[model samples]
Target chain A: MSTLEITDLHVSVNTEDGPKPILNGVTLTIKDGETHAIMGPNGSGKSTLAYSIAGHPKYTVTGGTVTLDGEDVLAMSVDERARAGLFLAMQYPVEVPGVSVSNFLRTAKTAIDGESPKLRTWVKDVNNALQALDLDPTFASRSVNEGFSGGEKKRHEIAQLELLDPKVAVLDETDSGLDIDALKIVSEGVNRFASKGNKGVLLITHYTRVLRYIKPDFVHVFVAGRIAEQGGAELADQLEAEGYDKYTSALR
Target chain B: MTVTDVARESVASALEQAPVVSHLNPLPSYDLADHPVPTGREEVWRFTPIKRLRGILDGEPSDARLEWDTSVPEGIEISTITAEQARELGELPPNERPAALAVARSGGAALIDVPAELAPGEPLVIRLTGASVDDLVWGHLVFRIGNHADVTIVLLHSGSARYCATTSFLVGDGARVNVVSLQDWADDAVHLGRDAIRVGRDASVKHTSVSFGGDVVRMHANVEYAAPGGEAELLGLYFADAGQHLEHRLFADHNQPRTKSNVAYKGALQGQGAHTVWIGNVLIRKVAEGIETYEENRNLVLTDGCQADSVPNLEIETGEIAGAGHASATARLDDEQLFYLRSRGVSDVEARRLVLHGFFNDLIRKVGVPSLEGRLTQTVEVELAKTVLAGVPLGASLILPVEEVAD
Candidate 1:
């Protein structure tokens, strides 16, 4: 089974003031078939952890070690990280003009799998994935995420997660802008992916609503770039009853 | 009778209903001796680097050797006629000095005439290959399409030479014509040409210019309607590499009522000293009521040290026109798009290649010539390799399947 390990990850981003630290000495570990929920308020460095693990050039890893199944994850390029079984469903999916969704999906699959997929079966798979997400078949011909609504963008991300089938999927705030119907559809897609056994999922969100659908195995409260508390699934229910004020006030 | 012939008969009868305007003036002519040499001060010649004209504007003609090969379809006639013969065939007067000089020094014009009501099944192709001679060369060509005829003309230019040519089209009533001019000259070649088209009543003309080669290439394409209910579509595609200057200027004058014009041009620039200029002008005269016009120009800059200048101008003296609009844009590669592609396991180099191909795909499809479309796609690929993809390592898998490798 694949294991993603992060040790004392110190991440910083360049801002107008200077290189401001976002993630300070944060540590987390997730193994295959485990769903880890990271619940944090705004400005708690939750998304920074996801971007850093995905090897985004914008986030600098000053003092940290990230390993995927004992392989150096921090040293890989963004595309290499993706090929090495890491996937990121960005909070705001970028609009890629001129690249059809079908082409993008096939290219990513080919690149990650190291071979071109069988056309007949691949087309069927893509259609099925899009159908599961409630996206029309014609959506495959349009430019990726270009002119798509907020809910459509999230649905497309889930569709990608299903098609790519990465070892570890880091979804950052995927439920923020989605409506109730879209939220349920997206959660169902994620559930289907997680049901495929031996897949790791790191769901970063500020609400416990998505947890009700996906049913995380573990919950961690993040505050000020560090994990303040950790528990089993019951902690999520407690946080929903209360709020992040206790955690933020304790950090202050 | 053919449908176009029937339409022409009806349009001829309806032409009497078009209003005559006394205020619509003709374009300024430089054929007279009093028209002073452009010091880069005139509005029309302001953007042109006059010093690089190689004395073509000073009445000095080059003795360069140019080889001509043409494939004429059946029922079409081609002949070499003197300038006087061409003028007698309704060739309009030159509006600029370069065209005037070409007409004055060419001594003769290559004329292609299509008879009335006869449509050729194949395109009329002409290949003009220039030798490495430094002397300036002047050429004049005329295409005459008779009433209700449909034709396609492909003008291909290649090799190296300092050349200037003036091409004129006389389209008859209700005729449909598509003229594609491709400038694929070798490096160090300088070219200046003017194409003037006169569209007849109820007729439509599609004029396209594709520029990819040469050190300095400039073309002026102007259109004027001979009668009402005419239509013109001006399309251009260009790629400018290092140390090259490519300029395309277009003007569509709507002097008749119920006329329409659409102009779209797209270009890409890369490397140092690469420059491209697009100037689109549309004038709707007071008498040209119910006219519709739209002009758009877009440029993609692939690298630093390159400049793309796009100017779209619409001068309308009539408020009764259906629609009139113009747009221009020049942009570099989108960083977000690059990141999105890269995040999907596409390498940096492959991502860029895809973006560049997509930038030119829409315009290339609009060209509407199957054979020409394939060649342009290959040309764009080669251009990308030469400039932007020069140093990047293109992965072996990106080009070929793993099974194809010998190892």
Candidate 2:
């Protein structure tokens, strides 16, 4: 029913030396009901790609066509893109003070659906999703992402993904700062969203540990701002066993 | 240039005995009871309009009255004091001087004290009204809160007579008090007020007030955290409609270690020739190490002819504290915040309310009383409705669903 497509995408950041490229000529597409894993080394522009696709104002999309279900995603505002069913499970989400997690999720859900959720159903849905991630119900009242531990913050991102139920999600290193237990819980939350069939996930990460839980149908290796290799789940195994030496040399 | 010249001229003038004329002594000798007129040259009065003082010699005397038929809310005790009784209290211990000024100036003033350690209750309403009498008049009140006491005093001053008011507050250690002083005077009435506050150790005093509908208002509030670990939160919300001018000046001093002070004052100016000025100075002494101080003054200019002037200064001698910051911004309605709200199905007027409510929410919620919060929300919403919804089709039957817009 829906798909997220990034074609010849290039990203950059403004620096003292003028705009410097981060993501270069990386093209990827994930149809609805598909799961795609993007593995890459640090500084390979994986997170940049995720933020750029989500329309983060801080990231500049220098060259690309990012569209969702034929809609020009790159032209949409941050909230507009989000409301269009695009979700980003940030590696390190910003801590928005005075905004509670439940409140944020409810607002996002309302914005995406263009209607208010049933209050009775919302409470139950939020509680169940939080429980699945081992989060305390009391966290609903706390400020969004504020004062949360590394593991708790990661779990919160997943909880948002589960509750908002976006049509497409960009998981940017969701397991980076997470421990083994938190990684499993986060992976489980991701798998739950994928099981919904209409949701597409672009899981970006460096390590292969999270792959053990949520097996990706396609894994793409990113190097020097572009995808260098594409294969099945065995690609994760090969990278984990042999490392990214060949891709690094090719990027050089 | 000196007060002696003004006093001499007044004493020598045939108009000296005129019904409205009040004796003016040398500047240094003028009792605090005698209202002081600014020459418009004084540093503190630089931003203030000088003409507001011209009516002092001709305005009708005030015969103000205190009307509270609804009775003071439970937990708060109120009593009146005569000028003679206050004078008997003498200079009042320097420590209690702030609260004593009100008693000293009262023809009949009210005294309010909340019991210690009692659960906070509904806000206490203190409504001061003045008859449309001929001449300048003065009223005063003294307020004291006991240890761990919590209360909100709504002081509303309104009338046609020229009114001068003085209120003094003493917050005991560990006490928490929120005071909302609203001044809405007649178009021709000149309202002058001075407030002095002394916060005890570990105590907190919050003062939020709005000045509107007044011809000319000059208000001064001086706060001092004289004991270690004391804290004070000061918020000023004022809106000057067409042809109105409101000036607010504040002085917050931190003389004890570990004391904290925060000031957030915002004003909206609209219509032709509406002018507002805010001058705030916060001093953190060297001896007041570990003290934290922050001040912010923001203004919203809603019309082309409206003007707002703000100067927030912080004098910090030591940096031993955890944090100290100050921010002041003056501009028209934020188009960004407005558009963001409007896109969410809120009409333009409702969108403005959301933005303005968000602007003041940081301070209103700090009042710590839900009922009072609701009341102030109504007050601000009404004022905003008058400005933003003016000439619009919104009727009394139109109720825009506010919902949970805070997040």
Candidate 3:
């Protein structure tokens, strides 16, 4: 019952040089029960699309309209968009030094649900979610992302995605830096989240190794801030073999 | 068997014969001639707002008194004695003018004795409440924690007063002690406080100074080892509001080999004219080899018109040491951290509350007063509500619940 629609999205990020344009007139849509993978090269603006959709203060929306179920997502604040069912699994999760994972998750859940979760059930849920990601129960007491290894940080993000249970999730490079075991665990967590049959997944990645496990229904080839081509899941395998050189050479 | 027991034989005879006092200190002396009124140009007085002292620097005697409310645990003795008796009990001499003035002007001193190996079940609470800002009180207190004894002592200040105190903690060998002096005065109050600690062999002492109120409060905690294997942890926390000055100074003198000293202080400033100063000075004498020491200070700026000065100093005379280092940082709330919290559905206001509270949570945990932790968190919330969270009620739904710090 969730539909995230992006129309002609344009984004520019602030740098010492200037507001350099990173995303240019990109359009895409993610509907319920569908997994869409946006695969591209290193500088393809794939992560930019994810962060922009999540309302990060770093990115400026020069142009475009993003809506969730016909409501203007562009008009909402970051937390408001989150409450409206848009979740972004950041590629580089920031470290919060003194906030424990359980505390953070409960706080976020309270904010999103507009009511505090029952403590007993919430603690059990958190432990279960962490265990599913191959994380220890004691990990709930650790400060968020602080001193976490690459695998731990990514796994924690997937844990949040499962617990927050938002309608539409835009994961930006959640599979990077994860080994095979971690990749499988994180993919399973994402699959579990998307398997609800009512949630939309916009899985953005640089490689097709993760796509093989998650099985995306649609694939968009991203190049120079725009989608150069579109196809089914087989396009991910093709990109993995042939790479994005063919897509970038035409523009060069 | 302990040095304290031997010192009980004769303080003058023991100290005069020890020949262990480091030349670098040069500040602790019983003579009033050794301490002079500062022109605010001296290293110790430069960062202080001397003019705001209102003649306290003159060291004039005052008969004013702060009403005391005490919770005396079992096996502890609190008695009034002369400052001369305190000195005879082996308490270190006053270092600076305020402390020397406190010892000179106060007619008598309060002495609390925790007998050898005695463990108190509850914290010995000494709550002092001043009647008005007009009261200029001089305080002298001597605390003697005996060998192998474990104890926690809390000294809380509130209401209004110009109070100057020279307190001493003489911890005996193998003793474990946690001393917390909380400066929660009224807005009009000014306080000049000092704590001089002599940590015995293998003893561990944790002294915390927390300043959240007062017009001008400058507090100092200085430590020196009585013998080797002594460990001292000095902690400080402060919050300065508009037009308020809160200063904390620490000096750790390692005159004995194989000793350790660690100092960590965190502060927050908000509103116009809010200022805080932290000076951490560690002096390692030539004989003090194989010592480990580190000092750190962090400040969070919550508003535009606030100033936080953090200075860390380490003077090592000997090259043969285990380790020595210092760190300092002053910054506003991190933007990326805010974005991460907000993207998780925490509102802007709540995210800020979490970050600011989180900034102090770790240090409060280190404060080690379990009963006072909750109250400290609430006090921080009230301080925040003054500016950054203005118009937000203490019970507002926007204020996130303070969680138990796990670190």
Candidate 4:
């Protein structure tokens, strides 16, 4: 079983002032077939944790240990972490100019699988993945994330998640900016992946509306660079009824 | 106020409100005396590294000739004629020093004549290959397209030489023409060339200049309408390696009413001392009302110590024009785009190559030569191999693995 364990991670981002610490003494774990949703308000260092796990050059890990299936994730480069089965669906995926989505997916698939995918099967898989996300089969020909609407960008990410099939996926605010119908479509796509029962998902969002569709096994109250509290799925309902005011007010 | 209201009081008052013409483009002349050798201080020659030109501006006489290979159809003619015959046959005169030298020293012009109503799906290919880098060659060519004709011309230059040439296109009424000039010269070759076109009434012309392999390549493409309703599109693409200097100058003169012109050029520079320049100018005279013109230049500096100078100048005399605009930009490889691609499991090498290919893919598609597209793509890949793929020491990840051959 694939397991991702982050132990007491301390991260800082370099700013005009200095190294501004964003994540402090944060620890979490997601085991096989488990979906953990980390609910936090703005400035909670949730997205920072996601990018750090994926080894973005913008963030520095002062003290931490991230292991994926007993392999040192922190020691690997960005692409190596990806090959080692770590995926980060970005909050704002940047637009890649003139690189068609079809070509991009194929390149990614080749890099992940260490060889070219079978053309006939690969094309069919791409069309099927995009179709399941309500994206047109023609969408495969477009440039990656270029000129995509808000819902389309998120759905395109989900399509990539399905096609890439990483061991652990860190979805950073995938539900934000999505309409109700698009949210349902994206949630169903996630549920289909979760149902496979071989992958681990760490869903980071500010809303409990998505948890209603894809049930999370656990919910952690994240605030101000650390986890304020932790509980089972019921904690999501409590946070929906009562926002993170208590935690932020305590920090204040 | 009768016609007497327009009477001149001295010559200065009558000329006070006249449209201003650019000094960058000197008046065209058949006499070589009118075109002077520049000292690198002239506005048109300021960006050019004059020393690297290797005395091409000196206009010395040379007897060398480039080997010419042509594919002329049955209805077309390829023959040699005197410069006097060329000018008598309505060829645009040279407007610059290098071009004037080319016409003055080339001895004669190669005339390619296409008959009226001759529409060929196949391109007319002219391949000129030089023998040595020490060879000093001058060339003059006049392509005459008759009324209502449609033609695509491909001019290919290769090998090594210090070559200066002038070419003219006399397009007749209602004709359509596409001319692609590919400068794939040797690394030591220096070329100074100019293309001047006179578009007849209702005619359309598309001229594309692509320079990939040259040490010092300076080219100019000038267009002026012979009558109203004519249109011109000037497109250019170039790549400059270390110590290479590539320059392109474009001039669109709207001498007739209701005309249109569009100019776009894209270039990429890699390695130290790699420099590129794009100068685009459009002059709309007072008579040229209701015209539309736009010019854009984009440069991608792929490495350190590379310079790209892009200048777009528009001299519009009439405010009644439909549109007039220009854009110029030069940028380095984007880090965010690289990270985005690498986050998808793409290796550093592949990610960089993909980003660059994406940068040029849109402009390459606009070349409109389907047969040459694959070749151009391959050439771009080869150019990338000299820098990014050759292991410029961008970490250990930039180098390709054993199994990662060309995909």
The most accurate candidate by DockQ is 3
lDDT of 2 at B283: 65
Pairs that collide, model 4: none
Classify candidate 2 by CAPRI docking class: incorrect
Q: Which of candidates 1 and 3 is the stronger one according to lDDT?
A: 3
Badly placed stretches (over 4 Å) of model 4 are: B1-20, B393-407
Q: How many backbone clashes does candidate 4 have?
A: 0
Instruction: Name the lDDT of candidate 3.
Output: 0.89
Question: Over the stretch B240-315, how does candidate 3's per-residue lDDT look in tens digits?
Answer: 9889999999999888899999999999988789999999989887778999999999998877778999988888
The local distance difference test score of model 1 is 0.85
CA displacement after TM-score superposition, residue B204 of candidate 2 (Å): 5.5
Candidate 1's C-alpha runs over 4 A off are: A42-44, A206-208, A222-224, A238-252, B1-27, B30-35, B62-65, B81-92, B115-121, B146-149, B172-175, B319-322, B392-407
lDDT at A121 for candidate 2?
Answer: 95
User: What range of 10 consecutive residues in model 2 chain B has the weakest lDDT sum?
Assistant: B398-407
The per-residue C-alpha lDDT of model 4 at residue B376 equals 84
Interface RMSD of the predictions, in order shown? 9.0, 11.0, 9.6, 7.5
Each prediction's whole-model lDDT (CA): 0.85, 0.71, 0.89, 0.88
Instruction: Return the TM-score for chain B, candidate 1.
Output: 0.87
lDDT (Cα, tens digit) per residue for candidate 1, span A1-252: 899999998988757886789998988999999999999999999999988888766677888789999998877777888898899998999877667899889988998899999999999999999999999999999888889999999999999999999999999999998888999999999999989988999999999998888899999999999899999999999999999989888866
TM-score (all chains, Cα) for each model: 0.85, 0.72, 0.94, 0.93
Worst 10 residues of 4 chain B by lDDT: B398-407
Give per-model CA RMSD: 8.0, 9.8, 6.8, 4.2
lDDT of 1 by residue, B176-280 (tens): 999999999999888999898999999999999999998889998988899999999999999998888999999888888999999999899887889999989
lDDT of 4 by residue, B1-407 (tens): 55554553323343334433555588778777888889888888999999988898898899998999998767898889999999898877787899999999999999999998899888899999999888999999999999999999999999999999999999999999999999999999999999999998999999999999889999999998989999999999899999999999999988789999999898999888999999998988777899999999999887787899999999866688999999999987676777777778998878888888887887788888888789788999999999877756443224222112111
